[model samples]
Target: MFEPEKQLVGEWVLDVRPEEVRVLVSGFQSWSEAELRPLTDLQAVPMMKWRHEQGHDPAFLPSGEAGVWRSHTLLALVRPDGSGWVGCAVDAAHTFTHWEARVDGQQVRVTCTSEGPAVEVAWQDTADVIGTLETLSAQLGRNMNAITPTPLRVWCSWYSYYRDVTLENMLDNARLARQHSLPFDVFQLDDGFQADLGDWFEPSSHFGGHASELPAQLDALGFTPGIWLAPFLASPTSKLFRDHSDWMLRGEDGQPLPVGNNWGGPYYTLDTTHPEVLNWLRELSATVRGWGYTYLKLDFLYGAALPGVRHDPSIGRAQAYRNAMQALRDGAPDAFILACGAPLAGSIGLVDAMRTGPDVAPYWDEESRRVWLGDATGPSARNALHTALSRWYQHSWYQPDPDVAIVRRELSLLNHHERGSIAGMLDIIGGLRASSDPISMLDEEGLALLHRCLQISTPDRPTTLAQSFGGAVTHFSRGTFNLTNQSVTNLPAHAYLEQRL
Candidate 1:
C-alpha cells in the first residue's frame, strides 16, 4: 500500500499481491481505480494445487506455479493539484522486472516490465486521460489474452526469396490467412525485394517489378502491407556502397565492418553518426512509404555498434537506437517500425513493436535452428517465460512480439503432443508471427489449433509457481485452483484446475 506523507491533493492506493495487483485512485472522476492483471495469466492451462516451494519443485513448471512464492514490489504516484493524475510502477526483483503506469483523470498510461523488461510511466499534460487508460488496458489485456494460451492475431511475414516463396504465392497466402479469420497486418517482403541489398530501390525477379502492387493487393484483401529493411546495412556489392563507402562503419584498418552471420559476403553498417547516413536513410524511408508500406520491420539494428568501433560509447546503446529511430521517424512518420535483433532498452519511446526472441526457423528438430528455439526446450521455455515476465509491463502502442507461432508444421516434423506443448508455450509468449508458406498449408485441425491459440485472453491473476533450468511454470488464477505436472515419461503433461462454481 502507498500512503504519501505530504498533504497531497489526491490519494492513490497500490495493492500488490502474490497473484495479482490493483490500483485505485480517489479524487478523480474520470477513471475509478482499476485492477491491472498480468498478461501471462491467460496462457495457463487448467491446473489445481499449483504452488512454489523453496526446493523440490518440478524443474520446468508453468509461470503460475513458479511465481507463487516470489517476492513482489509496487510503486505508485499522486498528483498534488487535484488534476486526477498519478504515476505508478511495479516490479518483482526475483524476475528483474519493472513497469510504468500513468493514471490520467480517466485513461491510464500503463507499460509493463514484461513487455519491454523496463517501465516508463510519466504524466504528459497533452495526454488523453481516458483514451490512454483504455489503450493501456487493451494492450495489457492483449498480453493477458496471449498468455491465456490462445491465439488472437494470426500473422505471417514475407521474407521473399529467403523462404523461397514468390509474391503471387504471398497473395494466395494472405487469402488463406483471412480464410482462417486471422488478420494479417504485416505482409513483409524481406531483403530479397530490392535489386541489390544497398540499392533500396527497384524490385527483383521474385517480386516481378510489382513490389508496390503486392502490398496494395494485400490491403485490398484486408491485410496491412509490411516490408523489411535493415536501415543500417549495406552490402559491399550495393550501389549505395559504391557511392557512399565513407558512410559505412570502418574497421581499425579503415575497411568496412561486417555484421550478420548467415549472409555469405561482408556487409557494412551505416555510420549513423554521419549526417549523410541519416539523410540517405530518411530518403529511403520516404521511398518505402511512397511504395505503400505501412509497417517496417527494422532488422540488424545491433550492427550499429561494434566492440572496437570509432563510435560514441558515451551516449550508450540506448541513444544509438534513438538516433536510428529518430531517423526512421523522419523517414516514414506514419510507418509502424518493429525492431528486430535490437536491444530492448534502446527501443523505448521509439519503435512500435519489438521481437522479444531470436528468429524461429521452420524446422522442429534442431534447437538452434530458429529464434524461438531456445524457448521450445524446458530450460529455454523457462528463460522465455522470465523474459516475457520481465517485459510485459512495457507493452502499449509499442507491442512486444515474442516471435513467431511455430504450431502449424508438417506432421512428419512434429507430433500432436509436441504440437500441444508448443501451442501451450506460444500462449505464454502472446504476440505471434508465421511464415507465408505455412499459413496456406495448415489443415483443418491445424487451423483450429491456431484459432484456439489466438482466442485465449490474458489472465486476471499473474504469478510464478516455479522456475528451474529444465523449465519454469507461472500461474494466474482468479479463484482457488490446483496444478500438477504429469510429465511422466511417455505420458502427456497434465493439470487439474478447479474453480468455485
Candidate 2:
C-alpha cells in the first residue's frame, strides 16, 4: 500500500508474503513505453533471488557496466543486519536481464536493462538463512545434479606456501598430516604447480613435469585431491600467450587487455567466446576432473566475464562469462567447483563454493589502509573477516568460503590475539574451513587452536543490530559461536563490526 514519492518516476506493485516479498516494477519511461510496444505474454518466473556479490574489486559496488564492476551480480540486495544474509535459487541461470538491485537507505530499485520489457524480483527474509538456503539447495539439486559440499578442513598451500609450493612441499605437508594423524579433508595445491597460467595441462618445472601425481598421492593419504587454477587468465610468460596471441581478449583498439598484475606483469584474459579457447577450456576441465581431483578452485574468474572485444561481438559480457563456466560444467559436472575471486551474480549454481572475500594474508592488521580500503583490500585477514561476516547470508545457497586460517607461529605476521580472532571468525562464518599452515611447522599451541576451531560451529542468527564500540572492539553472534575483533570491555563480548557508513 505504500506508494513512492512523485519524484521516483515509476509505478510499482509489491506482493508481500509471510516469508518473502515480490516486486513488480513497470510503467517507467522505457524506449518500449515511448513506442507503445506491449510486452508479449509470458509466464512470470516463480522464484527470483538476490545476491550481495563480494565482487572482484575489494570495494564491491552494484554495477551494470561490464569489466568495471566484476563482483556484484543479479538480485544484489542483502539483509543488511543481524545474521547477515542473502540467497539465490539459481533460476536466473544464463538469464540475466539487468536484475540489479540498487539500494538507497530503505529504498531500492530493481531495473531491467536488457531486451526484457520489465523486471520481476523476489525477496525473502528468515531468522535462519542457512536453513532456508538448504531448502533451496535441495530444490536446486532436485534432479540430483548439485554436489553436496563436504566440510573443507583443507590443508591448503596458500598463505604459508603461496606460489612457492612445489611437489616436495606438498608431499612433506601431506606426510606431516599422516604422521600426526591430523584432520584434513583435502590437500590443496594452490597456484605454484601450473607450468604457466594457461598451461593447465602441463606441470611446472618445480614438479619435474608430473604434477598429476600430486593429486593421486594426496588421495592415497586419505584426503581429497584439490587444485587451484585461474582458468580465465593467461600469464604473459605462458605458452598459451606465445602460441595464440589471437586467443587473448582485446580492447577496442585490438590490443590485448591486461586483467591485473598477478602472475608477474599484467595477466591477459582468454576470450571465452572464441571457439578455440572454448574447446581448450572444455578439454582442460575434463582433463583435470578426470585426474581424480574432486575439488577445483577456479580463481580470478572475473576475467572470463570482463567487458572486451571478443571473437563474437554479439555476446554480452555476462553471456560470455556464463558460456565459459557452462563449458567447465559440461566438462566436470561432479567436481566441487570452489570459485575464487569470481564474479558474484554470474556464478550462482555454476559453482559449489566461492571465495567471498580477498585472500587472508599472514599479516593480520590493515590499520593504515583500513580507512582507505574499508574491507576491500586484498590479502588482509581483518578485511576478510569483515567481508565474510557481512555477506554471510549467501551461505544459505552456495557456501561462503572465506580464505584460510593461518595459525603457524613462524613466517606469519599475525600475533596470538589476531590468530585466535581469525580462527574464531572462520568457525562462526560456516563455510569452507581450511588451515594454510603446515602442521609440521605448527607448535603444540597452534595445533591446539586448530583443534578447538574444528569443534566450533555457526552460531544462531542474531536478531539485533551489531553494536559498535569505539572502532577497535566490534562483535556479532551467530548462535553456536560469538566472534569479536577484540573483547569489548565494559560492554558485551561482541558488537557487529559489519559496515557503518
Candidate 3:
C-alpha cells in the first residue's frame, strides 16, 4: 500500500471530483529511462522513442532519467520478473484518460487526468507480464465485442500513385492483379479521390466523371471496391467549409480549430456533436457505400476527437468521437469500416479493422526528427513494426492492420535485406495483408515475393519479449526478426533480440 504521508510530493488534487484517498501500489523499483524502455532494459541509452500519434494506441516509453512521459487510456510498469502495477481508466468511453509519469530514482510519480467524466482507474498487480496484458485486453473488449472482418488481401493505390493517381492507374493495377492471379479482395483507392477533404461526393478531375463508374467496374471484376477519405476533416477550400462554416469545430477565439497541416495547408474538424454534421456524416457514408464501394478506409480520423468547442459540451472527447463513428456505422451498415489514425479506445466495436501502427514508408527508418521531434509515430517500416509489436495484444479488440507491406523492388528505396525484413515482420505480426506497389512495374522476382507475402497465414498471438540485450536485436516466435539494423537469424522461442534496419 502507498503511504501518502511519506510519498506524496505535494498536494494531489482532482479537478473534476473532490479529493479522495486511494493507495494503490508500494515498493516500485528505482525509476530510470532504462526501466521504461517498451519491452527491454537499456540502461546506457538515456532517451527512448515514444510514440504520440493522433489515432494510434499508446505504447510503453521507459525513461532512463527524469523526464515527463505520457500515455493515453492505459499504462503498465513491469520488471524482468513481471512484478509491477497495471492501471487503466475504465471510463475511457466518457472521457480521455491522459497519464503522465515523472521518474526520480526509486520513486516514480504518476498523474492521471481527464477532461470530463470522473476518472476511475482500474489497477492490477501481476507477476506475469504477458498474461496480465492478455487479461487487460479481454477486460477492455468485454463491452466492445468487436467483430474481426474476414482476413483480406488488399491492393491499394496510395504508395504508388499518391495524389497523382488517375482512374487509369487503378484500372491498370486491377488488370495486373487479375493477370497475375493475385488474391486481392479489396481494391482500395486511397486519398486523391475527393476534389477536397470534406467533399467526398465530388471526384477529382483524375476520375473524369467516372468515380462512381470505377467502383461498379471493380465490382464486376470480382473486387470489393474501396475508397479512402478523412470524413471528419474539411479543407479550407472545400465546398463543405464554405457552405457550412457553423458545422466546424471552433477554438476559444470562435474561429475554426485547425486540426493539422495537410493538403498544402491546414484543415479543420467537423463538429460531430452538431445534428446537421452528424446527418452529413450519415449521408456521406451512405453516398460512398451506394457507389458499390463496401470497404471504407477512413483515414486521419483523429480530427473528430481533437480539443475544441463542440456543439455539445456535456459529453467528453471520447464520447464525441464515438458519436461520429456511430453515425458512419448507421450509414454504411454493411460496409467494411477500416479505421486508420483513430483513437484506440473510442473506436472499439465501431470499425471492422484498425490500423495498429503508423504508416509504413518504403524505407526502413526515418532520418529526420526536426518536424516530429523524434516521435516514432511517423511513416517508417521500423516505426510501424515497433509500435505494432508493442501493442500486438490488441488483436482481440479488432483486426489489427499492420499497414501495407511494400515488397515490390521498383519505385522504392528499400534494398534487398531491408525489404525482406519488412516482409518478415509483417508475416509474423499478421492482420490485414495489403500492398501498394504498382504491380506492372515489378519484375518476376518482385512479383513472386509479393505472392509469398499475400499467402502468409500466421495466427495472431501475444508477442512477448523472450530476452533483451541492451535493446539490440529483438526476436519473435514462428520467426525471428530485429528492431535495429543488426540482423537476427533463427532464435529459440521467447528469446528477445533487437536489430535496426
Candidate 4:
C-alpha cells in the first residue's frame, strides 16, 4: 500500500502486475535527493548496482539500430488506440529523452501492451523527483534461498587433469577428507568422466568400466556424489547433434550456431523451448539419477537465454531459465542443483546454489589469470571481497558458492602467502567448495591450509567490508570474509575478526 502524498525517501516498494511491475522508488523529497545520489549511481551504489551493471557497455547499440547509442532507459505507454507516448533517458548524459509515463498523484506506472520484448520498468527516486523509465524487454529472475535445515557446507569439484584423478584416486581422497574431518558434503567429478564431453553417456576409459560405482563409493565414504553436466551444450561430435542438427540454435542465416572456444571446437546449444529437447533432457536426468548421482552442476547456462531465438521472449530470460530449471527439477526432484555462469538475479527462487565468481585458482599468475589475478595493484581478492559482501544476504536466503576454495597443493604454482590470502578470504566468506586430491602431489602445509578452510562456516553477513571497482568483501564475526577479485590482474584481500561489530 502507498499513500499518495507520503514521502518515500528511505524505503521503496515493488509490485508486479500481469503485464508489468510497478517499482515505486519512494523515500526522498527534494531536500534529500542529494544524499540519495551516491546510492543510485552505478559507480557508488554498492551491491545492487554492481549486479545490475553486468554485461552492459557504456557505449552500446541496441538491436535493430546502429550509429546512435541505445537509450540507457526506454519508457513507453501503449493504449487501446494503438498510439501512445515513448520516453528515453541517458544516465551518463544526465538527459531524459522522450519520457512519458502516466502519473497517478505521485505514483507512476508504465504499461506496455505491444508486440516487442517483455517490458522493464526502472526508476530512481530522488528527494525532489522520482525518475522512471520502462523498456520493452524481458523480466529478470530473483535469487531464491536454499532449503532450510541444510547448514552451509563447502566442497570442491574434482579436476582430474589437475591431479591425475581417477575413481581410485577419489576414494583415496575421500579417505583423506574423512581423516582430516573437513566439512564437505559433496564431491563433484568434473570434465573427465564422459568418453568425451560430446558423448554425455559414454564413460571414459579411465573410469575403469564402472563410472556408476563412483557415487556409491562416495556414499560409503559419507559424501554425496555430484557430477558436472552442461545441459544446454552438445559437442559437435555428439550423437544428439548427429541425430538432430536442427535442434541446435541457428544464426540469422539459419546455420548452426557456434558453441564458442571455451568448451571446444564448435558445439550446439539445445533449444530448451522445444518439447522434444525438454523431454530428452528429462530422460537424461532420469538416467543420471538412476545411477545414484544426487547432485548436478549446470554450467554455461547463460547460452540458453539468448534473445530473438525460438524461446518465448514474453516470458523473459529469467522465466525461460526457470522453465529449464523446473524441467530439471521434474526429472530429479531430490537432486541438488548448482547453477553457474548465469545471472544471479535471474536465478533467484530457482537454483539450490550458484557460482558467484568465474573460477578461482591456487595462486595468482597468467595460468590462473582467467579466474583471479595475483597482483596487489590489481583487483585480486579485493574485487572478490566486494562480490562476497554484496551477495551476503544470499547466505541467509540461499546457498552462495564463492567458487572453489583451492587449497595449497604441491603441484599448485602459488606461494605460501598467496595460499594464506586465498585461504583467509574463503574462511571469511564461508563458501561451499574445497579441492585437495590425495594423489595430487601436495605437501603437509598445503593440506593443512585446506583442512583449515573447510572448517569455516558461512556467515549471514560479512565482517570486514571494503568496496572498489564494482566489487567488495565482507568479513564476518567468525574471522572469515567473502572476497572477489574482479580485475584481470589486481586482487584484493581483507581480514576479519571473530566478533560481531
Candidate 5:
C-alpha cells in the first residue's frame, strides 16, 4: 500500500488523504526559459507560470527542490510503480493562490499557497491513473452516472487549411460532406474563420463578414455546423484588446497578461468577472447559435482561468473559468461544448466533449521527439494521442476528443503507417472523432478507413486500454472490434482481438 504524509510550513499544510497514497507536497513553478536542453519533470529547474496556463495537458515528471520554484495549485503522488493516486486543488482558492505537484524519485508532494478550507481534493487508489481522475470527476459535479456520450465523426478545417481557411474552401467541404457517402455529424470550421481571437462576431475578409449565415448553410446541407472560438482569449491586435484592455486579466504591473504563445501570438485573457465582458460573450455566443451553429469548439481557453491577478481577486481561477463557461452555457444552452486548452479539473460539469490531448499535428515528431512535458501542452499529434491515453479516465467525465484523425494520404507528409496509427488510436480511445481533412480530396482507401473508424462505444460498453507502451505501441479491443495504432500489417488480426481491453 502507498503511504500518505502531510507537512506544515508557513501556515501551508500538505496532506495526502487517507494515508494510503505515498505522496510529497510542495509549491511548484514551471521552467519558463527552458532552452534546447529539454527538462522532464524530475530535473530541478526554474519554471515559468505562463507557459502552461492554457493549452494541452502540462505533463510533469516531479521534484522537491523548494527555493528554486514557488508553490502552485495542483499536485499528484504515486508509488514507484505508478499505482498511487492524483489530485488537484478543486475549489481551494481562498487559502492559497499558488499550488504545485512535485516528484522526487518515488516520493511525491502537493503544496498550497497558504492552506485554507477553499481546497477540496479528490482521491482514489485504483492503480490506474484514469481511475484517480475518474474519482476527481465525481467531486467536480460531473458524475459519470448522469452522462450519455455519443461517438462523433467530425470533419474539421484546421489540419487541411491551418489558418488559411477561406469561405470558398469551407463551403466546398460542407458541400462534400453532404454528398459524401461517409457518415458525419458535424462539419466544423477551425481557427481561420474568426476576425480575431476573442472578437467572434466579426469575420475576416475571407468570411465576407457573413459567418453568421455559414452555419445555416451547412445545416441546410444535412450537417450540424460547428464553430470554433477561444472564448477567453484575444490577440493584441484584435478589436477586443484595443477597445477593452481594462477588461482583461492583468499582471501586478497593471498590464494585461499574455496567457500562452500560440498562432504567432501573445494572446490576452478576458476577465470573466467583468460584467461587460461576460455580457459580450453571452451575446456573441447566442448570435452564433442564432445563426444555427450548434457545435462550439472552445480553444485557447486556459487564458481565462490562468492563475493571475484578475479584475475580481475574490474569485479563484476555477470560479473565473466557471463564470466564463457558464456564460457560454447560458448563451448557447443547446450547443455542444467542445472544450480545448482547458484545465481538466475545473471543466468537469461544463463541456460536453473535452479535448483530452494536445493539438494533433499532421506529423508525428518534430523538435521534441520524446513528447516533452512542455510540448504536452503545446501542439503535437504524437503528444496529443499520447496524452489522450494518460487521460482516458476523463472519458467518464465527458466525451474525450482526441483531436483530428487524419486519413488523407496525398497532401499529408505523414507516411501510410503514421496515418493509420492516428486514425486507429482515436477510433479506439476518443469518444468524439473528427477528421481535419478535406473529404472531397480523400481517395477511396482513405475514405474507407474513415468509414470503418466510426463504430463508437456504447453506454453499456466503453472502450478500455488493454495494453500500451507509452503510446509508441497501443492495443485496444472493444467488443469484437480490435484496434491498434500499430497497423494491421504489423500485427495479425486475431492477436489484436485476442488481447483484452
Candidate 6:
C-alpha cells in the first residue's frame, strides 16, 4: 500500500493477492512531499501494441495540461532529480493489468485494473527510474519463470523481398550465405510464404505451392529453417474464418471482433479459450515443427488477447493469450518460439525470444507516424531504436529481438552515419542480431557492416539507464560506445554512437 505524505483524496477496495490487484487512486498530490523539484514528470509503459502508442515516450511530460496515460501492467511517476518517485506494478498471471492516469485540473486520478489474476500490487519509492524498472522486471521474470535463450543470428526475407519473395529469392540468399560463408544460424521466410494469415498449412503461389522443400534446402545450406506466422489472427477471406466462424472471438452483437486492419482488410482474433481453437493451434504448431523448421516467429499476437466474449468466460485476455501459447508449446516442445507484437507480461515465460520494438524500415522515414497522427508505434528506424532502447531492460526475461538490422544500401534511404548509428545501438544493446538485407546485392563494405553487427556478445544484465536529454536524444553507455543522437520520432531522425574512453 502507498502511504503518501499528503492526505488521500479517494480510494477504492484493493483486492490484494500475489498475482493480481485492482485499485483506484483518485486525486492526490505527488507521491512524496520532498523538497527536491522534479526536472520532468510522469512515465508510463504501454501494455501491448506498442506501435503508434504514446505512453512510453521519453519526452512525455504531463505537468500542467490535462492528459491520460496508460500502461499494460506497470506505471511509474519518476523524479529524475534524485528526489522521490513512486512505481506501481502488478503480477499478471491469469489476468491482464492496466493503469490509466487522468489529469483533470490540478488533480490526478489513476486507476489500476486487473481483468482476472489474484490481486498483488508492488509499490516502491526510489528516484532511480531505470534501477527501479530493472528490479521490477527481474521480480516479474522470477514470478513468470521466464527463460533466457542464447540469441541466434538470423536472415529474414521480410524487408529484403517483402511479400513478393519467391523460391529463387530464398535460394539466392541461401546460396549467397554459402558462398560468402555467412555464419547465419537461421534462414526465415516471413509473411509472404503463407497463403493467408489464418491458413498456415499451405504455401502461397510464391513458392510454386511448396514451402516444405525449402526447409530441407535451407538445412542443406548449413542453416536452421525458420518461419513466421500470426497464429492467433484470421483474415476475413481466410478459410479458417469462413469455415469456422464460431472459432472467432465475437462481440456483444455476436459478430466477429475486428482485431486490426491488415492483409487487404480487417482481420479477426481467434478465441484461444475455445477448445477447438486450442486444438487447432496445437496441431498448427506440430505441423510447422514437423516441417523441420526449428525457429518460429509468431507475430501480431496481441489479437488473441483483444477484448471479446470468449468460449471460456472465466479466462481473461492475458490468460486467453497464454492458453494459445501453451498449446503451441505443447505441440512444439523443442522448437524455438519468438513472440512479436504480444502482451509483454502475458508472454514472459512462454516464448524463447520476443521482438522488443516495432518493425525496422529500410529508411529513416516517419510517414507512418505522421499518417497515424504521431503514433510512435509505426515502422521506422527511429521508432524501433527508441522503443527498443527504452525496453532493453526486458532482456532479463527472454532474448530481446530488436527487429532486423537493415544495412544494405541498395534498397534503403538511410545515410551512412544513420546506418552506422543503428548498428552501433544494436551492438551495444546486444540482443538478437538479425538482418533482412539481400546479401547477394551487398557490396564489400555493406557485407562487412552486416558481419560486424552480427558479431555481438550479449552483455550481462543491464543496470545503466537510457537518459533522454530532450529533443528525443537518448544516451545509454555500454562497452566503449554510447548512443547519443537517437530520436523518439519527434525531431529529424538521426542516430550516432559517440565513443567514451
Model 5 lDDT tens row, 1-501: 111123232222234332233232222211111110111223233143445444321333123243212323333444434455455445422333344544333333444443333344444445654345455544444432324357667788888888888777878887776676667888888887777787777777676546776776777778888888888788999998999999988776788877777768678888888888899888878988888888998876766655557777766655777788888889999888888766554566677887766677767655452334323345555556555644444566678787777777767666655666566666556588788788777888887877766656432222223233332223344422222334354453212232344
Q: What TM-score does prediction 4 earn?
A: 0.65
lDDT of 2 by residue, 327-376 (tens): 98788888888887665545666888777666778876566544333223
Using TM-score, rank the candidates from best to worst.
Answer: 3, 6, 5, 2, 4, 1
TM-score of 2: 0.74
TM-score of 6: 0.83
Which candidate number maximizes TM-score? 3
Query: lDDT of candidate 6?
Result: 0.65
Clashes of 4: 61
How far is 40's C-alpha from truth in model 2 (Å)?
A: 41
Listed in order, each prediction's TM-score against the native is: 0.60, 0.74, 0.83, 0.65, 0.77, 0.83
RMSD of 6: 8.0
lDDT of 1 at 5: 18
- Which prediction has more favorable TM-score, 4 or 6? 6
The local distance difference test score of each candidate is 0.46, 0.57, 0.65, 0.46, 0.58, 0.65
Model 4 ranges off by over 4 Å: 1-149, 152-164, 311-316, 365-386, 437-442, 460-471, 474-501
Clashing pairs in 6: 17-119, 20-118, 20-119, 20-120, 21-119, 21-120, 47-72, 51-377, 52-375, 52-377
Candidate 3 to native Cα RMSD, angstroms: 7.8
Measure candidate 2: CA RMSD.
Answer: 10.5
**Model 6 Cα lDDT, one tens digit per residue, 1-501:** 111111122222222221111111111100100111112233222223322111221112222322454455565443334222233444555665545555544444556555564567665656565577678877888888888888899999999888888877888898998898888999998888878878888788766656677898888889999988889888888899999999998877888877666677678889999999999999998998999989999888777766667788877666787889999999899999988877677788898887776778887757544334444455777667656655556787788887788888887988886687678667756768899998877999988888888886664333333234321224555422222344544333364544454
Show the lowest summed lDDT stretch of 10 residues, model 5.
30-39
> 2 or 4: which has the higher lDDT?
2
On residues 317-392, what C-alpha lDDT tens digit does candidate 1 reach at each position? 2344457667887989888777765644345456666665434334333344212321122123223333343333
Poorest stretch of ten by lDDT in candidate 4: 27-36
Q: Kindly give the stretch of ten consecutive residues in candidate 1 with the minimal lDDT sum.
A: 26-35
